[model samples]
Target: MTEHKPEKKVCVFCGSSFGVDPNFSKSASELGVLLSNNNYGLVYGGGTTGLMGCVAKAVASNGSYVHGIIPEALVSKERKNLDEIKKMNEELKESVENHRGATPLDDSYGKTTIVPDMHTRKRMMAQEADGFVAMPGGFGTLEEVMEITTWSQLGIHAKPIVLFNIDHFYDEFIGFLGNCVAKGFISPENGTIISVATTPEEVISKLQSYKVPEGRFNLSWKNQ
Candidate 1:
C-alpha cells in the first residue's frame, strides 16, 4: 500500500497597503493565483484592503479556501482601502443572504475573527503553517518574518522561511543579515534558515528543498 502525505499549508505575510510600488501588488496577486492553482490554502491577515485583500480575493475567486486572522482593534487602522471594504461587505452580504436565511442589516456583515494583536497573529500563523512566505510589505511584514525566523533559530520550529524579494525590496535587509553574521549575532552556517527568491515559483521551489535536521539544535541563549 502507498502512503499518503499530508498537503502542506503555507502562511503568507504581506502589507495591508499596496505600498509605493505597483510591483508589490502585482507580485502578491501572482502569488495568490499560483497558490490557488497549486491547490494550496492561504492563511493571512483578514483585511479586505490593499495587497491582503488582493491576494485573498484572488485566491477566493479561484475557488480556493483562505483563512484570515485579524486583530479587531486594528481592523479600521490597518485597513488598506475604505472603498474596497464597503464593496466586500456588500458582496459578503449578498452571498450570505443567498445561502442562508435573511438576517438583520446590522448583522449583515459577519464579525471578524480577530486576534488580540500582531503577536497573536504571528503565533497563529507559525502554528498553523507548514512554512512561511513573506511578500513585499512594511513594518508589520518585517515583524512577522523576523518572528518566524526567530522561531526557527531558537529550535521552536523547523519550517522553511522564504522571502519573496520581488523588485529588490529586501536588498537592504539581506545586507543587514550579512552584518549580523559579521558581528557574531548569527552564524553564517545557520543562515540557511532563510531562503530568498524573486518570484512565487522560486519561493516554493526553495521551500520544498529545505529539510529539517533529524536532531534539533540546542538554542539556549545562555549556552550561546
Candidate 2:
C-alpha cells in the first residue's frame, strides 16, 4: 500500500458562488472525498457556500479534518452555510449509528477561524497547508493561486500547486501560462510550478508525484 501523508494538508482556493456548471461543485466534493480517503486534511477559505462548502462537507462527512480560515468580515455571511454543514454532519452521524459494521465517524465537523483581514487569512492558510489547489473561481481565487505561485517562485516554499481543471475551466489560464513562457515573461523551467489536473484522482496523483522544479530563481533579503 502507498504510504499516505496524513501530516500534509492541502489548501484549496475557490469561489464562494456555486458556478453555472454543476461539475465544478461536483469536482469540489469529489476532491474532498479523495482527500479524506487518502488521509489528507484540508485547509481552505472558511465558507459554507459554493465549492468551499461542498468540499468541506464532503471531507467532514467522510471523517477527515478540515480547517477553514476566513476574514472576520465574511463570517456573518457564512453563518447559514456553517449551520447547514453542522446539520448535515449530525444527520450523517445518526445514519452511521444504524450500521454497526461501518467504521465510526469522527467528531470532526471542522472548525472555522476568523481572522482580522484577508491578508491574515491568507498568511494563516499558507502557514497551515503543505500544498495548494485552485478550483473554478473568480478574481479572489485567481489572486490566491497567483500569490502562492509567486511565493514558490521566490523560494518561500516548494510545495506542489495544482489547478483542478474541471470542465476545462482552467484551459484559458493554462494557455495564458504557456503564452507567458513563449513570450519570455516566465521561463519554461519555472512555468512547471503550477500543475494541471483534470480529475480529483489526477489531482491527488499529481500532488504525490510532484517534485519541486530545480534550477529556479531564488530571492534573497538583499535583493528585496
Candidate 3:
C-alpha cells in the first residue's frame, strides 16, 4: 500500500485593498502564480478585494488549491470575490477537459471556510498553513504575520515565515525589528525567525530552505 502525503499550503498575509503602488498588485499576482507553479497550495484571508483577491484569483486560475479562511463579520464584504471565483471556475469547467489529474471544476475550484469570528478565522488559518508569507498590507497584515512569528518564537510551531518586501515596502518594518533586537527587546537569534524577501522567487526559495533559528524557548504550561 502507498501512503498519501498531504499538500503543503502557504498562508499569505496581504492588503484587502490595492495599495497606491501598481507593483504591489503585480507582485501579489506573481507570487500566487509562483506558488502554484511550485506545487504549493494557498491559504489566505478570504477577501476578493485588493492584493488579497488578486493573489487568490491568480492561484485559483492557475489550477492551484486556494483555501480562504474568512470571518463572518467580513463575509458580506468578501463574498463577491468568492462568487467571482465560482463563476470563473464554472466557465473553465465548461470550456476545458480534465487533464493531468486535475480536479473537476464542478467539484471545487477552491474553498472558503467561514468562521464565527476573527479569532477563529485566524486560528484556523494558522492551523491550516505549513508556512507563512507577508505581502504589502495594512495593520491586519502586519498583525497576522507578527502573531505567527511570535508563535514561532514561543515554540508553538517552527513553520517558515517570510516577509514579501515588495518594492521595499517592508524596509521600515525590517528596521523596526532590528531596533528591537538592538534594544534587547528581541534577541538577535529570535529576530531571524522572520525573513525578508524582495521577490516572489526569493520568497519561495527562502520558504523551501528555512531553518528554525537557535534559542527558541519551549514553553510549558505545567511550569507556569
What lDDT score goes with residue 18 in model 3? 84
What TM-score would candidate 2 get against the native? Answer: 0.82
lDDT (10s digit) by residue, model 3, range 1-224: 12113278999998877889999999999998899888888988766667877888888878888877655454333233555544453222221111112112222335666566888878888888999999998888999999999989998888999999999899999999999999999999999999889999999999999999999988863431
Q: Write the per-residue lDDT of candidate 2 for residues 1-224, one digit (tens) a residue.
A: 22234667999999877899999999899999999898888998866667877898788778777877665454333243445545553322211111112212223447656567899989899988989999999989999999999988888888999999999999999999999999999988899999999999999998899999975767663532
TM-score of candidate 1 against the unseen true structure: 0.76
Candidate 2 wrongly placed segments (more than 4 Å)? 1-5, 77-109, 220-224
Ranking by TM-score: 3, 2, 1
Using all chains and alpha carbons, the TM-scores for the candidates as numbered come to 0.76, 0.82, 0.82
Over 1-224, each residue of candidate 1 has an lDDT whose tens digit, in order, gives: 12122276678888767778888888888888787777777777766556776777666666666666654445434344435645553222111111122211112111234566767766776787888899887777898889878777778888888899989999999999989989988887666678899987888687788765443465654422
Q: Candidate 1 — what's its lDDT?
A: 0.68
List the global CA lDDT of all models.
0.68, 0.78, 0.78
Model 3 alpha-carbon miss at residue 20, Å: 0.7
Give the per-residue Cα lDDT of candidate 3 at 198. Answer: 95
